[model samples]
Target: MVWGRTEEGEQVPKEARVVFQPGAVWPEADVHADSCELVIVIDGTLEDENGTYPRGTRISAQRGTSHHPRSSGGCTLRVLYPDVVEVQRPAPPVAEGGA
Candidate 1:
């Protein structure tokens, strides 16, 4: 459960999202952007080259930082985003003169 939810119990803007995908791991995969983000294991286990994160573990990742999140033995987590980012621009730009 996210304590960062709004009064309506909906996700607030810039709210951190905790992904609780059991038995899911992406080796050497860093996903995210230039925003405040953190990955914490509310229940289960997770680890990367940096260190091993067990249950009740919290990790802090600043802006512009990236890490490969890997979970062993499956887990659930609480991700906190101090700031939310609006993905405003696409990676590739549209044709210059197209309306």
Candidate 2:
């Protein structure tokens, strides 16, 4: 599945892990069209559809779902997206405190 690493001589994906900064996200939406996903926030915090994800938080979502994830104070995540898609959310509304 992934570039290299395979299991049982089959096309199984190898074990993988990665860390993303505040405004980063996973790409490669094509393959993720019908796959479930899992994301474990190992450290720090993140913003999602419901709210924020603190350390030790394990978030799960359905396949073909979408979300805009961001870590304001930085975070380290262990993510497993059976497939990956880039979900974009609208920017936050500007403050009315004048420029």
lDDT leader: 1
Model 1 accuracy (lDDT, Cα) = 0.64
Measured with C-alpha atoms, the lDDT of residue 32 in candidate 1 is 49
Query: How high is each candidate's TM-score?
Result: 0.59, 0.55
Evaluate all candidate structures by whole-model CA lDDT and list the values in order: 0.64, 0.60
Q: What is the C-alpha RMSD of each candidate to the true structure, in Å?
A: 12.1, 17.1
**Residue 58, candidate 2: C-alpha displacement in angstroms:** 0.8
Tens digits of lDDT, candidate 2, 1-99: 232212223243322355667666545332333456677888888676678888998887786667777666778877675553333346999889867
Candidate 2: worst 10 consecutive residues by lDDT? Answer: 1-10
* Local accuracy of candidate 1 as per-residue lDDT tens digits, 1-99: 333443344544454445546667675556445355777687778877798899988788876677777765777776766665333334786588758
Name the candidate that leads on TM-score: 1
| Residue 12 of model 1, lDDT score | 43
